[model samples]
Target: MPERGATGPRVLLRRLREVMAQPASAQVRLDRIVKIIAADMVAEVCSIYLKRQPQVLELFATEGLNPDAVHKTTMRVGEGLIGDIAANAAALNLADAQASPKFAYKPETGEDPYQSLMGVPILRDGRVLGVLAVQNQTRRHYTDEEVEALETVAMVVAEMVTGDLIDPASLSGEEGRIGPRLVKGLALCDGVAIGTAVLHEPRVEVHSLIAEDPEAERMRLLRAVDELRASLEELFARAELGAMKGEHREILETYLMFAEDKGWLRRMTEAVEQGLTAEAAAERVHNETRARMLRQTDPYLRERLHDLDDLTNRLLRKLVGEETAAVYALPDDAVVIARAMGPAELLDYPRDKLAGVVLEDGSPTAHVTILARALDIPMVGRVGEMADLLRTGDPVIVDGEAGEIHLRPAPDVLEAFRAKTKLRAQRRAAFARARTLPPVTRDGVRIALNMNAGLPFDLPHLAETNADGIGLFRTELQYMIGSEMPRLNAQSAFYREVLDTAGDKPVVFRTLDLGGDKLLPYGRQLHEDNPALGWRAIRMALDRPALLRYQIRALLEAAGGRALWLMFPMVADVTEFDAARALVDHELGRLDRFGKPRPADLKVGAMLEVPSLAMRIRAMAGRADFISVGSNDLLQFYFAADRGNPRLAGRYERLSPAALGLLRHIVTEAEAAGIPVSLCGEMAGRPLEAMALVALGFRALSMPAAAIGPVKLMVRSLTIATAERFILDRLTSPAATIRRELEEFAFHEGVIV
Candidate 1:
């Protein structure tokens, strides 16, 4: 056996090349590779375990211990030390093998003589294909250098496994696919929904592995790399992606760095030099890198692998001359499953057919996840290996509330869930009975419970909830839902229907809040580093007056002698608000001069989202006819926390002293100036959050139609005067948790929660 540095990597590579130069059989080459590794490491035993099936790993070759055990000794994932390494995508190193808790004895292997052990997972794109391990006679700890060297060797083997060099069927005894598996994930939205699987991003199968011309293949690889760079540049050049300036842009930047890494390119170039096509070489490198990252213990590193995986796919598409994959015709009640996706891609699906969404990778605060919540779709994210586990139209139940998935569930289990689902429907029906009840407090303080409407379809929900009015009429949804930007007449007709449906109830229209995640497909593409705080909302509208002008003109036309309340979103300062209002005044003058019917009563307002507006709340109050707090964006901007990241979701509590202090300041300023202030964000939808708002001097709240009943019930059961007192008392207590304290007060005061 070679000792210490007696056999370096160059020597091992030469020996491996010498062995392969003979043009032996696949089995012979695989066996020889393990033997050389054992000799180089001076190990008593070295073995290779390939995934014979998704759940089964078989000992394909061995240099010592027992050759008879090859292809015979097998372990299901999570069964033993080797299985654990494959299951968790993590390497295992131990001085004593049998004494370890995960140790499992195999009678056929005869590995009792070996004490120390090291095992590294062979992976491709976060999927484990096999495990490589070495054992020694004496107890010893493997160094970092040893692990890295062995991992490099494992990468070579991974390429062979994924390519035509090795037949997957020959290695696996299982005929085809595995069935009925549970995939864990991060729960994004709360609900339970049963539906058929609909894959958002279908896998692209690569047929060619070896190249006919090495030089041509290298050139092909280079061209694909250039095209990939162009595509990324085009993505950054978009005005629509302005919201992605920080973390989102950083992801692509890191990917570009990896794409340009000389080590990565050298590996692919060397593979091409060794008679593989550019596609084949890149695939091998991608799979090897993916497998290694999947095994990493660091969540951040593991998460970053998703980007590399995405970039690899993009390069392959360029090489294949394929445009972006398209959404298939969805089945009724389809549960959309994706690895990860942008918000625009999620919106492309037909909303009625889409029942739920399950993702292999996504954070709770991701933009698409927020859209899922708004659309009332049950969602679960970070579901590992979801694509491998199920096919299209497979029966699945996505339990977003519990963060569980039931695939091909047993009849008994289905029946149990059916009953649970029915009971939930009954509870919702009971809540609907409160629609006719007045939103007056126990002490007769009048509270306004308004519903927020988006699409034209949302009008029926307003009647169902008997909301006070449409507190926020999101006009952007109309643009988003359309295949192209609707004509000005089309926009006017839609607005007319929305107001007509409300019938005497007031409706506040938030003018086209596009840019960032709300971008229309037909509008000009935006390239922004961070659209959320950048040129979005009022900024986009002000810069592009034609777009804002047309929208306001439509609103004026729709109102036609009735009152028209228009709100400008993402107003940074009082001056921005005045400028937007000036546009509206200009439209009014044009209508008057042209002898056309205009809005009989025009009410202008601003969305309090940016901190600058809050700081100058008094100035805003003096100019604006009304003010509505967009709690979602306001809180998001206030903490400088990306609302799309699940890790930072609970970074700051809504009812915290700091948050309350900000709300109190806004409320005080608005009330002193005699302007009505309402909260129209996700925060107002929850009963607890709405209670907090009422205590902080907010008289009006707007949320989704379903939330109105719960929020209204809380309002009817509590006294604002008492809530105000509770607020004053807690203001002085630094440790006060309004969420808990208010809930306790509500309970004792006979308020419904």
Candidate 2:
């Protein structure tokens, strides 16, 4: 206890208030707080620790023992005396602390003559931010008044650290520029992504520290462990009946095992025994484990890294006391920068809040990348070694499709990026405006434009793009997102919504096309050297009658007397198409007999995506009502190029004479058979390709919502007769530079600049 002449509580508070009022930094305020506390308590040392980041308590200011160590040291959530207080969300006061059972000594901190110690957690909203402590050489017990006074001081310090003492300079600027600029490693996902950088969303950092009381610490750990077990139970319970496959559930079970690992819990207890906070201990272990795993060469072990990272993040939150939302805070329109992102994690993020994604590690074939493409967010990936170079609030630019990034760009660079953004917006706007106009050449040749929809939001494109109707609605995406195999009623609801949205326009719904690269949420795996050639589309459907029958029934129920146009994807030959058509007929006949509702008029079609289908198109033309070319996959197969393989990407050209010849053949056969031919793929989204389709006598072209405007503009500028002649003339020519040739054609035709 201090002597009667020592600084009064009122005086100490006033001085702290004064120090905090100044425009000085955290370091300065912290120093002043430590000095006042030491003087008032007549202690040999006074220290303040602040939560600088997740599970990280940094030593900000101190007096007495090793002043040099102050601001130069950091501990995990549950490190030493200070960490323990913060971790447990409690206070500690002891005379002769060195002799206490819970005492932890640090060699780097050097020796201290202190015989007494008092510590308190700096808390906000019942959450621990850090700790404040004072030590005295005299062997003496701290009084209740002394503890109260110290707690009051801690409150003041917490306020300062938490930005309760805000300076204009402290706040992040409107443009995300503040403090000393920092560069960080960013994870990229998509190859072409461009958007404004924004702050990461906040997630729970730390939870609670190990209690000083052995029994109490044990109870806390056990409770957290139980909660973890419950989490796993719920996950498993949901998975049992959910849409996800057994393998996904297996991954979840593995995560549960990692959480319950005996070694992990033992380390937590050890930290508590050492008087380190629980959060600190867990974080230390997690970081060490991460470091070790990073060095491992095994692929299986490396994948386990994600499991560990997730479990550690969860355990650390429980220990240090933080929520998952604290990990990032994003604006409505912002780009995400991260080391990497799992597909599940990406689902939690708001689509509107996400403008683009920049990743440090990701490939174009990654699931998250596919999702990014689906969302139409520009993304750039594989910019390794960015996390260390960039800070949380630093400016970043990502070009998703192009795979480019600019950090702390110069004025000219910023202007150029902004200009590029404006041009893209302008182009999109132009496309939307053209949607109202018919997809016809300036000479007045009519062409049918449609949209390829997967989600409900995609329905609006039918109206916005002035598309004739949905040429292809991928029915499997709904199943991919759900937890269970969606009931027939649920599928009916969505199908009805799409049809109603289209009104009188034709809406072609594709059956559940799962297999190959497209993974099913439910556990069903058959490893093959080439999945693309293996079971998929009609092949998988033919085997899984239950899956195919369900979709057919849903379509029939949803049609509700309306005209329903349906198609089967990846039909290899006329026989597959015939078999698929027979199945649909069987379903229709069964529904009629059972008095189940179905469309009064249904048009059945098949996608000419496979090369075999194209070869047998003449036979298929008479058997099928309509034929739509799935050009994206068709071109890949035609050239023997794996479209998703980055190494082989850009190796094959869609405009190559061979691919074009096949397309011409399909169109001619379809025309001769008097069947309407359309294209639903990425190629149709391009302006020049839209023109090519027009020349090839494809009256219908279906694309994504965003591409409608651009393609419309190209259609409006084209002269169908001239385009056909120009393309045919080049078809026989020996062209080494096809892209250049196409560009020259576009320039000559005045379809694009």
TM-score list, all predictions: 0.57, 0.61
**TM-score winner:** 2
Clashes counted in candidate 2 amount to 81
- Range of the 10 consecutive residues with the lowest summed lDDT in candidate 1: 168-177
Residues 173-198 of candidate 2: C-alpha lDDT, one tens digit per residue: 22333333323322333333334465
In terms of lDDT, which candidate is strongest?
1
lDDT of each: 0.78, 0.69
RMSD of 2: 15.1
Off by over 4 Å in 2: 1-318, 321-334, 340-356, 360-395, 401-403, 407-415
